[model samples]
Target: MALTTYSFKDLSGSMSHPTIGSYIFTGEGVGDISISMSTDRSAHDVASDGSIMVSKIAGNNGVVTITAQQTSPIHFWLLDWYNTLWNLPTSEWATTSMLLRNTSTGGSHVITGVSPQKVGDIPYQQQGQRITWALMAADIQHNSK
Candidate 1:
């Protein structure tokens, strides 16, 4: 019913290198949510073809069971110049739903229907390295007592 933003940053050297990011949600009765991402570039060529992997930052044995809704769409883009407009979509785009556990165990439960869709160009920029992803949850019609 309500919308919240969870942000994580990669402190690793360059965009070419892989780094782990983390996010934490601490609210009561949190259920049914969607997630998405936005990039700054319009295409991903040999010069800048990088991928982002989203997962629970905490180990697989923690206390929360985070799930993605079916309608939620994940997206990526590639930009041309700095603040310019010459971008195109990339060939590597996909979406999937899964359940992430926050514990010491190292495993995840993949859910069905929740997947990422390639709707726009795949951008590649060092400044755009900060991936902006969002999640929307299913509507809570009402609460019964």
Candidate 2:
């Protein structure tokens, strides 16, 4: 499938609900937003005689790296959401509902557990006050067929 990335937006063009390619993304920006997934995994092995045996290995949840940017008012709101969600007292991070859809291939997955940024310094534009944020997805779906 020719799955190219595209900017996701609502009919009214609000950042509240957006998608990157077929995957739903949430951010406030006007830029070349992208989504890339990496599977969480573990591996164990045993060495006996002259051979190595795989003891255990498994793929856990995954992460979706999101990069996006916004100008002015939207940037303001984006910063607000990121600040509030991460600065809270809760140790367990909250997740947002995300969906990955491939209409051409008829495949999809529902992901949860998106983390909020709190501890790091978010980059800001010097000119137009453009807010560009690089988000790493905390948890994600496998996009099972």
Candidate 3:
């Protein structure tokens, strides 16, 4: 058998928001999961051994861009959904999988690691298809365990 993998940074074609194990996202049409990451590093230098230690580890600071699109989409309710997800109780954190798994793809991916913050500044744009404004997430995978 061959092992396949998906990336959060993937924003290729029309794709639905990845399933949170089974926690489904309502209203779907060409949804996409686009997120970004940044890292902060510290260096330690000791004269005793003349060695410097550099670190570039996971579970650092990062940002998220969660969005969805519809051909003849709902105009305004997206704002409500975006704001609602942001303020959802900590328990309602959207646990995301690292692999791409949707109705078009296959079953659900089994890696629950992403936790998004409140979606902010939902501004819609129209290109080939009507798309929901890319709402910025507070944080994504800042504490990967």
Model 1 lDDT, residue 139, Cα: 16
Expressed as tens digits, the lDDT of each residue in 3-122 for candidate 1 is 744322211111110111212332122233332222222333443346644443321111112232222221111111111211213221112223333232232233322212222233
Q: What TM-score does prediction 1 earn?
A: 0.20
lDDT of 2 by residue, 1-145 (tens): 7565433432111122222112224333544434556553544465676565644444334444333444444445556656665556454345444565554444555556555444324554674433445445655554534
lDDT of 2: 0.45
Clashing pairs in 2: 29-69, 29-70, 30-69
Query: Which sections of candidate 1 miss by over 4 Å?
Result: 1-97, 104-110, 119-121, 126-128, 132-145
lDDT of 3 by residue, 7-64 (tens): 4333222222332123233344435554565455554556678876666554444443
Off by over 4 Å in 3: 1-28, 40-51, 56-61, 70-99, 102-145
Itemize residue pairs with steric clashes in candidate 3: 86-118, 123-133
Deviation from native of the Cα of residue 36 in model 2, angstroms = 5.4
Ranked candidates, highest lDDT first: 2, 3, 1
Query: TM-score for all predictions?
Result: 0.20, 0.52, 0.36
Per-prediction count of colliding residue pairs? 28, 3, 2
Give the alpha-carbon lDDT of every model. Answer: 0.24, 0.45, 0.41
Q: Between candidates 1 and 3, which one is better according to TM-score?
A: 3
